[model samples]
Structure formats: structure tokens, C-alpha cells
Target: MPVERSRRLESYNLADYDRLPQCTNRRRLAAGIATIGPAIAEPIGRRANDRLPFPPSTPVGNIVLKLHQESSGALNTITSYGDGYVAINLERHEGSIIVMPEGAVIEWPVSSFEALAPEHFEALVAAAPEVVIFGSGSRLRFPHPRLTAQLAKHRIGVETMDFGAACRTYNILMSEGRRVAAALLIEA
Candidate 1:
């Protein structure tokens, strides 16, 4: 019995799991990644953000660009995100702004995450989209949840994400004919 146990132990290393490379299931891993590959590229839905390298960006000058869908004639889509600016509907905009398909581009005066005031969220009530995508700059920084109380009263939903992610998510939601609004903070 001791000898059989010894042989079994020799077949598997004590640190087998710890010694794993970036990918463990070599053959199956490739197939699995391929399965969710498209989702990893541009994840959709409210809870589909499983991948980290989302809305891949290319750097230009001080901007990091991630272009989403194209506009269907008058329908708006986020064309790209550049460093401290974003291009929507082939037009480049600097600073923060609120975007909606077939709606006027409303410029927001927010500068950075720390500058986010409750009134900032309060102001979005007028836009009145079913859902609001809050792009908290280049990285994901959640605002104080309480700030959205007013919007919540009107039964609006808010999803916060990075600038690039928000751009992609906005297009994804818009394409599905959902009432979506994107409030992007592009300065920092």
C-alpha cells in the first residue's frame, strides 16, 4: 500500500497547480477561448464584462483610441476614444459629454473622478434614457452610488465602466434598440 501511494505521488507533482503556465488546459484551453473569443472582444449585456482587455485601444499622441460601431446614416455610434478625447460620429470631442443615438451631443462640464458631484448625476435625469453608461475616464472608478438616487427614482439604470468599455457597450446596447445614453469623462 505504501509503495502504491509513493508511485501515485510520483505521477503528480506537489506543486502541479502552482507550476501552471499562463494557460493550463493546452488543447481544451484553445477551444474554450475560441468559444468566448467574440464575447471577449466586445462583451454585451449588463453583466457580461468577464474579460479585462476590453475595447482594445491604440495610442495616438496622448490619446488611446478604441473605435466602436459606425453610424447608420443618422444613428450615432462611438467612433473612437483618443487619449484625452473621443470621436463620435466621425467628430472628435474633447472633455466630457453626454451621447445618445439621434440626439444632440450635450457637453458635460466634469473634469475628473474626484470632481464628480451628486448634481452631476442629478443632471442626467433630463436626458431620461432607460439606462446610462457612465464612463469614468481611462480606468474604472465607481462614483458614490448615492449620487444616482434621483435617477433611480425615475427607474433609470446606470452602468459604470472605463471610457473604452463604455464606448463599446453603448454601441452594443444601442444596436439592440435599447434606450441608452453614454456620459463619458475623457479628460483624465
Candidate 2:
């Protein structure tokens, strides 16, 4: 409804126009476009149909991959997530993983917070992310202080959340160009 916050799409075809509410700012649409819905009569703006859709990889079970846009030396974004996996840049990986900005996805062999060991965190220390998103499966859980003490000594911060929040936060931080990592546990 807000004119300033309309989703700027790369390509808005007749089918796309057919899906919108009539009260929307139809005047903001590109010129020369066909009538989309019964209410859409004329085109509105210029060069609105020349955009390309970003293929954010969606998760399919445990392993899947798709084409994604280059991050321009940025860290990978979490495309989507589900009960047992998070899709990173069109690639769906299972179990636990260490996702870093500027590119490195180290598969961590962890299933749950109860299965975490000090050495599991040691891998993160070696990865040396400035901030870590520790996703404790489907629920909120925290690791032992000793497990993360070494990272604390290095001034590295770790935020604990559920798996879903971890995925979203990871994407936001990566887009911001932050030195962040996601240690996600997507199992019971």
C-alpha cells in the first residue's frame, strides 16, 4: 500500500499484475504494459519489466542446488530453511554447518546442542568469524560457557537462537557485509 515500499521486481508480467490488489498504486507500474487484472487498465512507469528474478535456492529435503547470483566477494546468503536443512545460495545442506561470510561452508558434524563438544567450537575458532550465530536446532538452547570461552577470549561474539531465526539473521548480516558465521543444528 505504501508507494515508497513497493516491491521493485525485475519482471512484472500480466500474470504478476493479475495478482495485485486494485487499490495498489497501479500508476507506479511501467508504461506500455498489458492490462493484467480486470481492474488494471493502463501501464504506469518506465523500464519496470526488464528486471531478472533472483533465484534464491529453496530447500528440498537434505541436498539440493540451484543457480544463484554472485555475492561480489560477500558471504553466502541463506536462501531458505526447513525442518532439517538450510539452503545456502541455492545449495541445501543438512546436519550442522559453519557458514562464513566471504565464502566458506564447513559442514559441522553436530546434530543437537547436547551433542556439541568443545572441539566443535574449536572449528569455529579456527574459522575465526567475528560473530557466530549458534542455531540450536528447532528450539532455543545454549552451549556450555567453556565451549565458547576461547572465542570470547578473542572478542568473538556468538548469538544463540533457534534454527529458523539463525537462518534469517545470517542472511541479514551477510547482506550487511558483516563477518558472521552460522553454526546451525537442524536435527532433533
Measured by lDDT, the strongest candidate is 1
lDDT (10s digit) by residue, model 1, range 26-113: 4453443465566646647544444423333533333354558654677788888868988888899998999998787888889888
Residue pairs in steric clash, candidate 1? Answer: 63-82, 63-83, 64-83
For model 2, how does the per-residue alpha-carbon lDDT over 1-188 read when each residue is reduced to its tens digit? 75786765454566667476641544433322232232233353332223212112433333232546655444577878998878887799977888886666778888767778888887877777879999988889889899988889888999999989988898888787788889888774
TM-score of each: 0.61, 0.62
Where is model 2 more than 4 Å wrong at Cα?
1-74
TM match of model 1 to true structure:
0.61
Candidate 1 stretches greater than 4 Å from native: 1-71
lDDT of the structure predicted as candidate 1: 0.78
